[model samples]
Target: MIRPDSFVPSARLAPSADALLFIFQEGRLLLREDGTLPQGHVEDFSVDLVNPLGMLDGRPVFGARLVGEVPTGFMLRPLRGVYGTLSEDLFGLAGYAMQIVEWDRTHRFCGACATPTVRSERETSKVCPNCGLTAYPRVAPVVMVLVTRGEGRDRELLLARGPHFAPGMYSALAGFVEPSETLEHACHREVREEVGVEITGLRYRFSQPWPFPHSLMIAFTAEYAGGDLALQPEEIEDAGWYRVGSLPTLPPPFSIARRLIETVAQGE
Candidate 1:
């Protein structure tokens, strides 16, 4: 998990000799040939907007979207493609940058009154000058639960694959938290709705900031309480209990879902 206080977040920035920039174009990040963030002043590139992303390693960092041609030796790749190539801190910053760009782009106008919104000078938010409405970079919280049964080397884990998952890949069950619901409720409801089962001893695990479009995955472990495999066709393509060595292709290690699985099913 990325530390939330890794750096002192600032609402302003001024590119200089030591500044680092995380620039994106159409949600794709710009990484250099050696897989690193661009550093120093970015005067050569035409940027649509630049937002401060706090201070890192005593260097000012900024996030922006490119309007100019891609710089030579710098490839525009999806953030997912740069997962293992960049440092954990850099990946976190990239996720932050992606979310900021999306928030700024989509919230140019007020949702309630349709008035143009202005970036807050005091913090990371946008304000509608007319209605006092404010918008911040928001993260939708999702719960990922890995259900387990039995114990030790013979321990079995309940895993499933979504319709959109890669071939033969399976991961923990997950769903978004709905309004007026607790995280625990969301977790149990998701498991029951998707697999027609109940889980107990819901143990809280770590979380990961997944930025496909700004979601915080809260992972957990639970004991199988009851019910049989009755997969919800619309949500789950397949689901079943499997031993560690027989597990299918799981989610990438960087994801919280993967961590939850590895925490219990450590072998193989």
Candidate 2:
């Protein structure tokens, strides 16, 4: 918010007079009406949760969730909606801030010993005083698969519509990675469970951090091997293999699912 062009910044620095703030209400970030980060004084607002979000251009960046009504000149907006409106670095900082704020708000006590936890000075974690156990923020990893078969113009993609997806929209098959399971195994399991299909050639692609709460999406491309198109009625409403020329409504461009489809489908 300070927009300092120079200075060394760190995640856990002593707050300075020129510190920048990222405020949120409910789960939405506080911004100006034109969708820029708020740079105004917030000493008047009551905060529900607050935590450091590292540094930007030499200023300590802190995140806070405001209590009660929205402040006078500022507005509350969903973090996703202001993607392009913010600088790439600032956008990432905002998402990370949200996760930290939520982690601090929820992990006030140790889960094991029921003792109040103390903040770690050098790390973003809570240390239990009684048990000496440390609790760090959790990032759940999810696997996304874009199943394909055939080649060239004959190539097709397996897309499915979730129960809550917009009407006529479809995307890649995805599921969270369970404990002790590998990414490859999660990919196969998600596709099989969601659509009852077997796949091969599990090619790992890029990943994206979706911080609605906290989720790391690892994407891959798999070739259809076997199994019929059996939708998991509750999770998936409809599914089918789609060719490039005839595709349904896809996800937003910001999502890894959409990027994964585009990487394979190319011209689509």
Candidate 3:
């Protein structure tokens, strides 16, 4: 697990040896053909496009944006595709870098006013000169619930596939937490809304930073309370209960959904 203490945020833009460069082009991460982070000084590549991410393991880390054309000796990969393959530490760092770059790119101008914004010298934020409004990185919270029913050999897990999911892949029910809603409330509401089923015995499991444009997925395990499966046509394409021994295609092992399902299937 990536701990908060692993990264120390700072505004200083100092380069050092062993520094990891997280370069992105139009949101895709830049990696060598071997699927490893390209290493070099900020000056070796393009310093003008680099942004100070923070310090990792006492080394200064940076995020860079490369627009148009693929540079030699490097290839752009979708951030999601590199999840399970990359080292856990590096993956966490890449996620952190991506979120910072996105926040900085989107907050170039103030929302309160039309004036341009400038980076804060003391913190990780953008400040509007005219209105004095500061913008920080936004992290949207999402709730994921793995709903199961029955017990022993007859126990079955309710898995649902969203319309956008690839092929027959089905996982837990998840949705973003609405404003003025508690995590627990969001869990219940999302399950009811997405699958038209009530869930009880909601137990908090764990959380993962899903940085496909920023989302903190808080996972949970719940018991099916009542109601029948009435899939939300707009969101869910198919949903069903499956016995432990027989299951369809699941999410990738890197995902929290897969972990949650494995926990229940393995009786862990």
lDDT of each: 0.86, 0.82, 0.86
- Judging by lDDT, tell me the better candidate of 1 and 2: 1
User: What stretches of model 2 exceed 4 Å from their correct place?
Assistant: 1-11, 16-18, 40-44
TM-score of each predicted structure versus truth: 0.94, 0.91, 0.94
Best by TM-score: 1
From the highest lDDT down, the ranking of the candidates is 1, 3, 2
The predicted structure with the larger lDDT, 2 or 3, is 3
What 10-residue stretch in candidate 2 is worst by lDDT? Answer: 1-10
Q: Could you tell me the TM-score of candidate 3? A: 0.94
- Cα displacement (Å) at residue 143, model 2: 0.4
lDDT of 2 at 95: 79
Q: Candidate 1 regions off by >4 Å?
A: 1-5
